[model samples]
Target: MVVANDEGGVKPSHGGPAVADAAPQVDHGMLALTLGALGVVYGDIGTSPIYAFREALVASSGGNVAEREDILGVLSLIIWALTIIVTIKYILFVLRADNKGEGGTLSLMALARGAFAHRPRWILLLGMLGASLFYGDAVITPAISVLSAVEGLNVVTPTFEPYVVPLTLVILAAVFAVQRFGTASVASVFGPVTALWFLSIGASGVVHIVDDPEILLAINPVYIVYFLANSPEVAFVTIGAIFLAVTGAEALYADLGHFGRRPIVLAWLAIVFPCLLLNYVGQGAFVLSHGGIVGHPFFEMNEGWALLPMVALATAATVIASQAVISGAFSLTRQAVQLNLLPRLEILHTSETQSGQIYMPRVNMLLGIVVFMLVIGFQESTNLAAAYGISVTGNMLMTTLLLAVVMLKIWKWPLVAVVALTSMFAVIDIGFFVSNIVKVLDGGWASLAIAFTMALIISTWMRGSRYLFEKTRKNEMPLGFLTEQLAKKKPQLVPGTAVFLTGDPLSAPTALLHSLKHYKVLHEQNVILSVVTAQQPKVPDQERARIEKLNDLFMRVTVTFGYMEQPNIPRALAICRKQGWKFDIMTTSFFLSRRSLKASPTSGMPLWQDKLFIALAKSASDATEYFQIPTGRVVEIGTQVAI
Candidate 1:
């Protein structure tokens, strides 16, 4: 079940308040489904304990300090960081920012667009920036999540140390290899596996807590306060590390359409939160007793009989994390296409049962290459950690800002409460954001590079679209104006009927320009056929076909349909035949303007970016086969255009 946000450009009516076939069921079966969803979707955030604690400890030391205080301070930071960002901010606050009960970057963007299309342009920029940052996070997530999981192998066995990189690569390869197959059937196991994984983490922590109950004192906010107040400089760096704990929290919002709000929220509150708290507590206890083992404290928490199960659970959790991001990339691409940031692609729904299980080959191949490169480039999970947290933090900050606008303008929440709550989040988000800025030169550039590239593409597409629309609107003739002239200029020449298919519904299409330029004669009877693709999934066949007469010569026609649907122009002709529409197929030439977009300065994009967009357009372009236009009767007129 995947419910699109019922806000945004071309909002599709999906029945009434609750859409049919949206949001996967909430039941015992879903409990199992939530595991897999949690496993893959929640993997990045869930497995942060593997390295967050270690990095915070290192940052706290600043290369010189007592290992005990460093361990305690770092552990306290991770625990409280999770409590504030995940439990309070995301779980308690941000989750409430749903767009017609749908969540995610796309959902949020849709909500903003619907409410603020006529508002200041800065609001749209914020929405796009958040979307761009999400794409950046998508690229880095798999790299860090799998790397962290494989790093655990080194902690358990010395022989496994040297093979961590290769093993992580292998695991990633296997995860991506199965993406085309879809996860509906196999997803049943995700909930149980993740459930056991979190439970095991909690149980392990309880054992350590039993041994050293005094470590529980770190849970108080005062310890976090003390660490921040006493070590302001070093604590800034800890902001970078603490962000790792909530890396996958965005997935909770992004994939909210999959499991619905209730199941996901319940799963997070009931199962995921408690286990995560326990694991952090156990790590704190382990750090308190044996602060000497500073390199990988998470691995040190387990010993003897427990180490092997811990290893197994961590690996399973890592798989879940990787899968979540992969699925997220697909959904994001889908949204991109719908919103026109991306060109059309072959979007294949993997499951007849679950519409959310989608497969995009171009996206999958690209992301797989990038993830594999990150694995080999970083060579270790710990190294990749530098690049991971910054993008997630940036995205979180973007979300907080966008939600403020939503609360005040859309939901009409009181300005004071929205400002106060958003300000608190802004302070925390900015602190983490500033901390991650220091990591820009230290492997953080990868995520930044990705963000920059995506932003460039999105911005270019948006600007180019505006330019194209403005240019067309200014130059092209409106249907009513053209029809009025046609009635007076060529009353004697009107004998046969001619239908011209147009790209734009508002103005006379480029196809008509090419047709009039090539052929000097005008037909007595003229029809302007414009197709309007609704954002909805289905349009009734009858309602999809509409015909209106323009003056006496021009027939203004429109076929309202969906991108997912197959157009039946021949059947449409059959219906028109009954109305005595003179059926002369041979002379009725269907014109289509094929613009040859150039990668030059005139395209309103950099040369490289123009080339990238052109290449993406070519790769994702729709084939002529699906449009139902006649093979021989259609003529494509080529025009070299800069856009």
Candidate 2:
């Protein structure tokens, strides 16, 4: 039997047991977290200098050699993009919308949902769109990051050009292959290695900036305006490429729970931002000095003696960038499953101490296959770059819309202030979205296709699950009335406790009804147990389980877990033991209803959708394994249902 836990109405009351406090500020380990943030949170954006500047300049010049103005203009666009989008909008504003120290699309959705007395459907749809877009980003990041880095070999020697794709595939395969072994052993060096990369790239930029001091003029925002006014058509295309520089900016907000706001902000300002700026300016300076020829400027800027070493370092940095995105995919999928957006996939913990270290075989395999196809199809970083930015731009627009609700309702900001802020962000977001939209025929459709597929799956699962719940609830007897009738007429009482798992605690479980019909007997003790997923990230131990004694013969228990947590039925029931329920696993038999669903023409959805839902239901992981319940103690009651 596979059942998704209810994700609503699990919030503890103010008078109830205290919830866990927000993660405390680790002042003592601030340096460690700052370094860690640079490695993980900044890896994606940090690696962008390798291709972002070159692409923008090339786009601005329209395949011809760039003029002095084009070089300065492209650099200016990249600079302000980082400033307004990453620095001002995300790090300054969106990070403040965190839901109890957790920041992500869904976390912000939960916060916005709670701000009002009643939840709004538009807010939920916005969150789903944002999350679905992230899956598109997840698929593209590894492909572009690694390909761009490996393409550096072409600069080292034309002899390596023929081998670039083969070499890239091998490296990408190894990256996904290592996911099962976990990142703990190698994570310690992520900080140091990435730190060195920043220093090297920064120093390289310093050398060229010294040679051509005039390139510093790009730091002014005026050049961006001048660039746009000079040629609107070319500038629009350049803006699309410039958006690449800020593609990973969302990671800064998504990883807020892992490293506190202070460390991430500090890391960007002190290290990541400055280094990226220098490298980009250096690339510009090199191009300008070489008469506006932009041929892999990032690699060509370095001296011949340093070229091979730089390529090696670039490859390692790209791998780290890919690792961060892959891990984020795993984390996001877990949140989706707990919230019932996706079916439960088998999750294996890689680290005993760190609950966040998880491996999902299905997600990993699927990502790997798609990534390989992308590499083979695109065959060049330049082509893959054409497909990037659409998803990130769409996601950014959704975040802006959702953040407006949080600002006006939760923060109690003046509506005027909220509108102005959202309008400013919306303008930038829409511009980027349109710019990328024009690239749909130039490979951007791949991302849109992936995102559309994911959104359809999420919507279908939600609708089908709701229809099943309503249908099941309509036929089942009320728990209150059923227990009353059973108390009045005594039956042969068994010795062990029989716990029936159900989504709707008010309605009697199907397993319980079938058990009584077949055996014509009742257990000495009965537990109506329901597992609930809270809106928050983690529920405290004191508020984990809520118990009520309906009568002497039956007791009701609702065990709550946060969306970020795994549900372990046995461990949760242990909490009931301490609350004087005398719960014993050895003397208990869990009753679960295993439904075999058949598709009907007259169902809530279309014929094909009904079949899809039935397939999804069958593919779901076993309830006994998913809930961490022992196999020997579980009793499955089979039932047939049409949906």
Local distance difference test scores for all models: 0.71, 0.86
Q: All candidates' TM-scores?
A: 0.84, 0.96
Candidate 1 total steric clashes: 7
- The lDDT, on a scale of 0 to 1, for candidate 2 is 0.86
Best by lDDT: 2
- Model 1 root mean square deviation, Cα atoms: 6.2
Error of 1 at 57 (Å): 1.7
TM-score (C-alpha, index-matched) for candidate 1: 0.84
Q: What are the per-residue Cα lDDT tens digits for candidate 1 across 1-643?
A: 1111101111122235877779954577666556656665566777777777777766777652336555566667777777778778877767777754557775675566567545455765776778778877877877887787777777777898889889888988998899988877667677677778888887878888765677787766777777778878888887798788777888888876676666777778787888888888787677667644566767767867777778778888878777878888787776665555655556667888776788888788888998999989999776787898778888888888888887888789998999999998899889888898899888889888888888887776656555545555577788666667766775445356666666555577676666676776667777776555543334566666677777767776666654334344555655555555665777676666666666667756677767776665555544343355577777677766565
Candidate 2 lDDT, tens digit per residue, 454-474?
999878777788777777778
lDDT of 2 at 402: 91
